[model samples]
Target chain A: MSTALAPARTGSDERLTGFAGEPLDQRRYRRMRFIRRFEETLLQLFEEGALNGTTHACIGQEADAVAVIEHLAEGDHIFSNHRCHGHYLAHSGDALGLLAEIMGKEAGVCRGMGGSQHICAPGFKSNGVQGGIVPNAAGIALANQLSGNDAVSVVFIGDGTLGEGVVYETLNMAALWKLPLLVVCEDNRWAQSTPIAANLAGDMAARFAAFGVPVREVDSTDVEELSAIAGEEVGLVRAGAGPRVLLIHTYRLCHHSKSDDERPEREIADRWLVEPLLVHGQRLDEADRRRIDDEVETALGEVVATARALP
Target chain B: MIFAKELGDTLRGALTDDPRVVLLGEDIADPYGGAFKVTRGLSTAFPQRVRTTPISEGAIAGVSAGLALAGYRPIAEVMFGDFLTLMFDQVVNHIAKYQAMYAGQATCPVVVRAATGGHRGYGPTHSQSLEKHFLGVPHLRVVAASLFHDPREVFSDFLGRDEPVLYVEHKLLYPQHLTLPVNGRIGDLLATSEGGPLPTVRLSAVPVEDCTVSVLAYGYQAMLAAKVIERLAMEEEIFAELLVPAQIAPMDWAPVERSVAVTGRLVTVEEGADGWSWGTEAASVISRRLFGRLRRPVDVVASEATVIPSSKTKEASILVGSAQIEAAIRAAAR
Candidate 1:
């Protein structure tokens, strides 16, 4: 019985000020921080036996969702993979619905049927299986193209998704048909318990380039830089420039899922230095960062409280 | 009308009527048409709506699902029914689950048309009655093209549905003319097509109540059973009722139950492999429905479990034909 407050100020509103006169960067940071806290809360819920089934959290990868989703227009479509909470929250700002869905409440986004991975909302969708939804995303792109709509389709995949054959199949069709598809590969360098080295072979960018789709590769945790790059890529796709691939080399700061981290502690400790929150928070005023953190925690508190109260 | 042409006309009509209706397949465009020629003249008729895809069955079905999710009714053709194995994950995991998984918020009105059954020595890969594998999948309708039914109506009806449909087309039936019932009679057999949406065509040499065995079949096998029923009546003097259901999955057992109540015996024949098939499920259901009323236990006639060979004689020996249907019907009578 919870009512949504307002659409998250994540979109490029161009008002220069966001959410009570704060800068857009602060809003971006707040969104990312909210997603981070949201995922962290899910882990705590799992420990408390409040949730059943498994959830793939985008704990360290929140910036990818916040950075890329800002460029999408109203009619544009987004297809996300298993690790989708960050993308879903950034795209629809429906944390209460998502939490309710994962909690198996009837008030959930999909009426508690889709749960975490198989969520479907207006202009947004996510499936748990790797690479299976790629062709679907291409199809949506084709639909937009055929209808003469300028809306672009964006699909997010992990480094492990490259191992699926359907990804290549969709890439070939998307490139040949000149569909407006932006494939955002969030290369977190790991697929569950297995490292990318053991799973993926050959070059990631070359795999996309070989399909004749344009590729843009960047390794950064700073949301501002990623946002700028994503804006350019998304604009190119919207202009009917065929499919574009933005391969963001990022890291998974949390376990693949609940209580399943086999990664060495030292490797994880080093990644903490370049984590998106720390890198982005460095540029914001100390008082402003604290205020944003406090606001995110307060909002997430209501989302969780309302979700728990739902039938 | 020719079966394939009627289907083509139906596609043309759907494309013309709704801009959201589209066709995607391999070699389905102007020059090559399709593998079975069912999509012939479609690409030329509706240039933007019809598209030829690469040799990717998974993508063809998956993309069609995507189009359907986006409010377009897309009909994707998987060159041959055997290639549906490649599309299993997409159809079963994604397309079929989308509606229920998303709690009815999204509807995938996609039609996947594939040419199935083997008569022209298509061997293992090209010829397969794989419809049984797709049965019992939630939110998916398995409808077959039969000579007794108008395929134009079938395709049009499939386009009208809010659920996904696997439109099964027998390869051999594509070239044959559709033979509708003449005043409810096909020669000596009385013919009637019943059920709503996709239909179940009933044929009997005698009054359905007086028949000794109720024969069940679908697609090309059903058409063959109709011919076999006529011969069985004229030659052997054994009366049997044949039920040809176009919609196999989510089967409407009303007609089947009505026929079996009086007939007391049932025989199911299909072109797919013997066990774990359409025949098996029908037998299981019919037996449970009529436990003591049946005169004899239900029987099944189907292809052998071996991979279909390329040689003409070898393939003929493996697939179900009129002989198998006649023998199964004769056996059921005793």
Candidate 2:
């Protein structure tokens, strides 16, 4: 996988390009764009008195969730961490329902009992605890593997979750049983205020490789490449190839939460230059980009309207 | 029959009958049939279903919840009750909240079985009756069996009920002889002896009258309470009724309350630490509900509120023994 931090030659401009004309690509692009806009609007929603409780928004890291989740079948399970708006929205693709949940309305997916951190729908489960979902995902995979079914499970975690012991335990069990599961670590460089360098002890890939999981690292900003890798690896896992780790390198363009104001504005600005949205959309024509933007805007409008209309 | 043998048989029977039942825990299979042998010969009977897991308490909990969500009834043995401190987040946050949080879209039908109580010198960490830690958690059930209440029913009734449960077992009660009730009633005051998890088996004193003090207990404490009751009846004619509810937390207060109403006194006993115990819950609720009728402030008999010691005498001192239970019963009756 390319480790280039600078945005690469985005993609060839032809519709016949291996990554562009595919229907999956369009759906992924739409969902990623929707997640970006959805999280952006959350800032305004927070500015107004619309949402209760805090949300760890995944604005810049949308590609990691969308890329893996889009390739997964509807029956496949996705367990998530606290940075979960993008994963739930990507798997279920229901911004209105998610927004309603945030607004505490009855029409929400969980009848508003589950807020942003615990947005659980069928086939998509997320809780607020870090590293808690790893073993649960392994168990879901165990069910599929035991029943001799092809329904795989994918878990999304941050580089920070490496501190939790259950992650290693789940990794060992997943490898031992040959459970069809993939662990996607979206290494967004920071765990709240702590940098990965200070927190990490040894090599990340070496740790997973010791557990016998096939490890692959990718540049999260390259959506097309990330999508292709996710598709291949998810297929491999579903086919009983045991567990794999997709260590996607990412950088968040926004604060960890609304209250997190410790980050330098200049560093965020520098990171946005290589944002997945700008890099991935480089190949889309003015009309294509405009159309995606229009659909996202219209969807956001419906979500906000529906959420506000609810008592 | 031995109470622990009954528990093992009940697990084997569930494995034979239900395809959805899956067992997960450390040393749960083959030569090691769980730490307490509560699952002996299970792997031999059904090798595919019984799985041995690493010492991942958190994962054991999470995997059980996940398995339940995926339509498998999992019985995860946590080896010792004290280890629940590690993985209990999955229980409290995920397993307990899944049904209510998801608005019934999901249900975690998992039973976590652990050996509890302070005896046989298992030391502070190993020998603790920790039902108090898990009691009153929403959407979760706490079930413990004494010499009277059989573990078989607990496994059969709750191991696959689309709700998460903590099934507690005591280390000392495994070898003790137990009598299985053919059928019984809770109390005379209850409208019916039947429905709900609070089925009480009342052992009437010889030439029984309106009972004196009602001794409320479960697990090994119930066994001790039964002994104290029998001794009190033999010697002092105290005539205290013993009420053991099958379920501890989400407790059904009607049976205990009715007994308390008839007796006008309550003595609660348990092996857990004195503060924040199931006995404490019983004493408090009964005191508040039956304040006017209560003959005295409810007497709560429980173990010491400090770390359980490894020394045999010290362990016995910390344990709520039959002597303390009998004293409490006598005081409540007076």
Candidate 3:
């Protein structure tokens, strides 16, 4: 399993380090790179038919998962949509268990019952569903409030999931009850093949703001920016300031899945071709970039080598 | 005879006995105490446990599912069972699918309580037996607690198990009652009752020990089935074993299968529409499993597959009574 590599360190470097001066340490950076490589490898295996079933790869949305998950404590809850490989990995889920789940193995996270779309790790109490777990997360947030626990419930959804009526209903109730919830919307500009501008009418942030929720928007590609904003938002929710929505503008470098090929639309593909890992890597100097690249490649190489050795 | 008041008291006592049990519903708090007064004084007794929620059926079901996931046994009420349709997403998709879809990642030990069935002209919106809607959803245990004694036992059994349960209480039977065996506590039946003149005829009794026929009945049909048994005993010297399953979804097949093995005949009676009813499904199961049991085919006595009429004449024509049950039993015997 391997991912196609983009040209390293070629894009605009000035705008990248503007937010929070790259707060990620070597360990965190290595972890995020691990997620990026893991997702890319999964996509390759899916295309090769080595892995069965469809997977929603978090190619460019790694920062959002990492940042939001970093703010969560061990007992904190997370609910994710179909595009949740990053969220599952960043929350310390078992890589083999997740892979097996996607492959429909009995040793999967849900014992092969729930496929790639329905991965749930009971240890972390993290669930992956197709926008249906939004209200369930709100209920979990309410439970946290009822129990007087400072733990927060975070739900990661796409801009398309906002179109679901239950999400809005859950938002309304979450706000009314002052539940500790963080609804992170990864606005990656496309809901499958359709563009978000063509589908959504008004501002996504304004909609949540209208519900009296403290809403924020950040550069979803920048790990530091997402971390800072997510930290602030998590604090606000933990302090009983009700539910909040963070609209993170990210990019989906790959197709929605291996089955979906969007290369026919060159203009659209070109516009959305912001490689998140390369962009983040470019912000650092030559030494930092080399160190990060080596670390990422070594970890990915180990994973691939290990995966191949499994019977 | 223990009435609805005693039943309510019994439930309150049970809740008091178990701290893990929590109740949430509309108007279940102090002063209001449930529409049918089943949860009367429960909120005051267990203030933190008994909670009142806004009229959000989806949230009610979802919250109960969450609490169950968190290891708290939550019994959520939908006030009227008709309103449960509003929460079909959470109940069917989330709560029911947790065990199977999650491969038992977490047990949804939640009980959804609601009052259902047509009685006292509550109109089309309020009066409906919608248990058939949730008949096939996996991992959800549906319990229709009609009699006072069976309800306590069913509730106890449901709470004892680590599965999501849909406890459907009849709106009309709320005022009715039955004398429980031990201080209003219905003990579990060790084996089904057998031993009547016909060997297939069994008595329809709550706090049932052992029975032969596994007579399936619920709501008003349950009372009618008891009367039919009594009349049969006096006139024809025929007795039929009755198995009133409090739980419906995972239809407690143990007793039902055992009863079928003994009697080799099964009769299902319901006061709901006949098309694709629970009775029909029960008949199918019995026929498939006990096909070579050397008796007659399973019989289903249910209401006509039509809209319940408002007029007395039309309603009587559409409804299933004791006579229909008796006829169904006779057909099964043949």
| Top candidate, metric TM-score | 1
Give the chain B TM-score for each candidate. Answer: 0.98, 0.93, 0.83
State every prediction's TM-score relative to the real structure.
Answer: 0.97, 0.93, 0.85
When candidate 1 is compared with the true two-chain complex, its DockQ is: 0.78
Which scores greater on DockQ, model 1 or model 2?
A: 1
Candidate 1, residues A1-311, lDDT tens digits: the string is 11112235354221111365557778788888888898999999999999989999987788899888878777889999989999998887778889999999999999889898989998899998888899999989989989998998999999999999899988998888999999999999999999998998888899999988989999998898999899889989988899999999999989998889999999999999999999999889999899888877877888889889987
Q: Residues B109-139, candidate 3, lDDT per residue (tens digit)?
A: 8788878877455656676678888888877
User: Can you list the residue pairs that collide in candidate 1?
Assistant: none
Q: Compose the digit string of candidate 1's lDDT tens values, residues B123-151.
A: 88888888889989988999888888887
Q: Kindly report which residue stretches of model 1 are placed more than 4 angstroms away from their true locations once superposed.
A: A1-21
User: Best to worst by DockQ, what's the order?
Assistant: 1, 2, 3
Candidate No. with top lDDT: 1
Q: What does candidate 2's lDDT look like per residue over A139-237, in tens digits? A: 899898778878879999999999999889889988988999999999988889888888998988888999989999886587888878988888889
Off by over 4 Å in 2: A1-27, B182-198
lDDT of 1 at B32: 80
Docking class of 2: medium
What is the C-alpha lDDT profile of model 2 across B1-334, one tens digit per residue?
Answer: 7877888898988988998889999998988788888888999888878999988889888888888889899889989889999878899988899889878888888899888887789899999888888998988898887666656666667853778888888888888877545444222211123344436655645422457878788888777777778777777777888877778888888878877888888888888888877777787888889989998888888888999999999998878888889778777777
